[model samples]
Target: MGRPVVHFEITGRDGQALRSFYTRLFDWQIDADNPMGYGMVAREGNTTEDGVGIGGGIAGMPEGEGGGYVTFYVSVPDVEATLTQVESLGGSRALGPEKISDDLVIGQFRDPEGNLIGVIQAMSQSA
Candidate 1:
């Protein structure tokens, strides 16, 4: 199998407000923090009933302009191996193997087009 879009981040101007909107609108359970400006919410992309990846977005604030979302994540069976391939393929890594939950390891990277993407390996599959 090939590397798939596993995880993605939604960057916006008002992250907290967005989180609230999603939480109430989508019925998504959101765990939010003020200082961290991050939301732990279940995005439809990575999660399915059976088992899949998980991701959320960083809370953003309006910074002199309109708000928008940026950054996305990809799903990989193995983060280390995929990261190697990314480097070899001329992709740049922003962060990695950051443990988000018990079974989730996330790596942030940029593709050849300079588009940011995230790779997620759920613990259920990691084992």
Candidate 2:
């Protein structure tokens, strides 16, 4: 794992609209609905910095939920291991350390005060 968040999912409504707005506003070339509605937000393949990664996505909500809020994913070597550390460090798990792809793993968790955070690692380094 590279201890980086190369991809991010922008959870919200009107995926196309949000994609369009960002594309025009920031001139971001977003490939929305690329696969299974997992739209990609990036600038070419240059989504990495040094060794860190940066990426985002867009998805729908259940009519009434937390939308339009961008979540921050911190770099970590292993989501499962990191979650264990988080729990031991006075944090709690809010979501799974699920594998979104062979190269990506995401797990939502919260701090002692209920502030959400995430952990991600690349597949290449995962081996």
Name the top TM-score candidate. 2
TM-score of each: 0.62, 0.72
**How many clashes (backbone atoms < 3 Å, residues ≥3 apart in a chain or on different chains) does model 1 have?**
13
Query: Which runs of model 2 end up more than 4 angstroms from their true locations?
Result: 1-5, 45-53, 62-65
Per-candidate local distance difference test: 0.71, 0.71
Candidate 2, pairs of clashing residues:
1-125, 1-126, 8-55, 8-56, 8-57, 10-57
Alpha-carbon runs more than 4 Å astray in model 1: 20-37, 40-58, 61-69
> What TM-score would candidate 1 get against the native?
0.62
lDDT of 2 by residue, 28-121 (tens): 6677545566567663553446645466665655567766556778777778988988899999998778998878887888899887777776
